[model samples]
Target: MSHDAAMSVQHPQDIDQGHVVARYVSNERRYLKLLGGGFLRLGEAERAAFIAALRADALQVSPEEIGALLGYEWRSRLTAAWLVGVARRIEWRERVGELLLASELTYAGQGYCFALAQFGGKNDAEILVSYLDRYLPHLECRYDQGLALGALLRLDSRLGTSHAERFAVRDGLWERWVDALPHTRGTADAWADASRSRIDAWCNLWDA
Candidate 1:
């Protein structure tokens, strides 16, 4: 059967059930189908449900599942990135470490790295800083580094001597991010914008 035909054969009720299953299955294609079908249509309740499922002990997906989604060639990188965002919301803090250890540099990894630095606690911040210091030179997506910088700035304003020094360094660090902004996928804009706004607020707080 043609790919579209196979998809059409899935019962509507099965499709909905599949969404619930996909949330727990730890399979990339299943996740792709469910997320692709439901991402745009998800209301706050559905999102909450998805998060709850993700957090359930019975549904604890493996790091390999996340790695596969991050590395999947046919999948939407942005969608995978958004999944990482969801993972962060589900309080999978340790998973970010797995993402950092994954072999490939995926946009999903980039987004997760940013989320780690943003929502992560002190240990997460330290890990992110170490990762950046180690990997920044080799990464092609320097914009992600900029996003990481923005996240770090938000994580601790006092990491630097003063807020001014932090902003100055962050401003310089974000130049690559600013240059790459025009080329990023539209779906990534929300993460990028949130990163920017947080950094901006930090700068403004010190300025005021």
Candidate 2:
């Protein structure tokens, strides 16, 4: 059966209940065409439907399709990154890291790297840190370097003293965190206030 036909066979109720495998398959196939064809006028209901479909099984996105998306323009890459953010599969996380590290598409690569850092574990952290140590100086944007720094921080938080001292000495990252603090809005008002206090405490400890 045709892709759209198959997707049509899936009950909308099934989609609402979180059965989105078929929908994702159909969407992936149509992504390029949808964009190129200028079908950007999806109504609220359709848009909501699409987002629900995406969230239902983002982790199931195949490596090949992910690779294909990495090759898309920056906007599409951002969409792919959002999908990765919702993904729960470790294998997909590994594949995302591999693609980001190897890709020449810098925009997508940066987004993928961020997603990997957000979702990845010790090995992903180690690989990313090693890559940053070697390549960060060559990166043009301070923002991009900051993202790598954030990833390192997340990793360090999990690894503790095993890697914290190493990160503490990374002047570029430490400086950037200091620079970024005033600009961060935090996760929410209460959480932001608490985080600010915690950060202040950490700063005080560093001074000591």
Q: Write the per-residue lDDT of candidate 2 for residues 79-190, one digit (tens) a residue.
A: 4664665463455666566544544343444555546555647876776666555444443333334455455555566566244345335354334344445564232234
Candidate 2 lDDT: 0.46
What are the per-residue Cα lDDT tens digits for candidate 1 across 56-133? Answer: 522344444444444333232333444455445435556555455342433444445544544546766675565555
Cα miss at 205, model 2 (Å)? 30
TM-score of 1: 0.44
Question: Which candidate comes out best when scored by lDDT?
Answer: 2
The C-alpha TM-scores of every prediction are 0.44, 0.49
The global C-alpha lDDT for each of the candidates, from Candidate 1 onward, is: 0.44, 0.46
Predicted structure with the largest TM-score when compared to the true one: 2
